[model samples]
Target: MSYESITLATIAEKTSISRPSIYHYYDKKESVFVDLIIQEYREWGEQMGPLLERRCSQEQF
Candidate 1:
């Protein structure tokens, strides 16, 4: 879904978290998106870091 269409209620419903609880952790819905982006990057690095460290010939690369 588009960012503009994402509401706090939508996020809460998707996560099964209450709106008040989400508010306790995030000032706004955008903050939750920022956290999600950071989490995705961290996970991506963890999955790709090992592959990047291994030696590979030009063709393999």
Candidate 2:
């Protein structure tokens, strides 16, 4: 579900979670987006790390 840059009220409506609860987790909507982006980057790095390592080993061989 690609939810575009959304306001807190929109997120609350989509999630069915109270706006206060969202606020409890994230101070602002930007913070929530940033957290998600960082998490995605970390996951991508983890998935690619082994591939990169193997490439380096092949180059050294």
Candidate 3:
């Protein structure tokens, strides 16, 4: 979905969390999106870290 169309209600429904509970962690929808991106990056880094640490050749990489 486009960022412009995203609302707190949209996020709440998608996440199965209430709007009030969302407020406890974020003051606005943008904050939720920012946090989501940060979380995705962290997870991606964690998944790739071990593979990068392995002694694989460049071709295997």
Candidate 4:
């Protein structure tokens, strides 16, 4: 979601979590965005780990 559109109130409404609870985990909304980026990298690494170890041809790569 766009940064301007993903406010804490909107997130809480969508997730059904309280706004104060969300704040307990993230000091600011930007921190949540940073954590999401980190999580995406970790999940991508998990999915790519085996493929990366294999010797694939350029066509496969």
Question: Which candidate leads in TM-score?
Answer: 4
Task: Report the CA-based lDDT of candidate 3 relative to the real structure.
Answer: 0.91
Candidates ranked by TM-score, best first? 4, 1, 3, 2
Flag the better candidate by TM-score, 3 or 4.
Answer: 4
lDDT string, candidate 4, 1-61, tens digits: 7878788777778889999998789777788878989999999999999998999998997
lDDT of each: 0.89, 0.81, 0.91, 0.87
Give the TM-score (vs. native) of candidate 2: 0.69
lDDT top scorer: 3
Where is the poorest 10-residue window by lDDT in model 1? 21-30
User: What TM-score goes with each of the models?
Assistant: 0.81, 0.69, 0.80, 0.83
Per model, how many backbone clashes are there? 0, 0, 0, 0
**1 or 3, greater by lDDT:** 3
Which order, best to worst by lDDT?
A: 3, 1, 4, 2
Per-residue lDDT tens digits for candidate 2, residues 1-61, read 4456677777788889998888788877888789889999999999988787774665663
Let me know the TM-score candidate 1 reaches against the reference structure: 0.81
After superposing candidate 3 on the true structure, give the runs of residues whose Cα lies further than 4 Å from its correct spot.
Answer: none
Tens-digit lDDT track of model 1 for 5-45: 98888899899999898878988788998999999999999
Q: Please say which candidate is ahead in TM-score: 1 or 3.
A: 1
Which residues of candidate 2, in runs, are more than 4 Å off?
1-5, 56-61
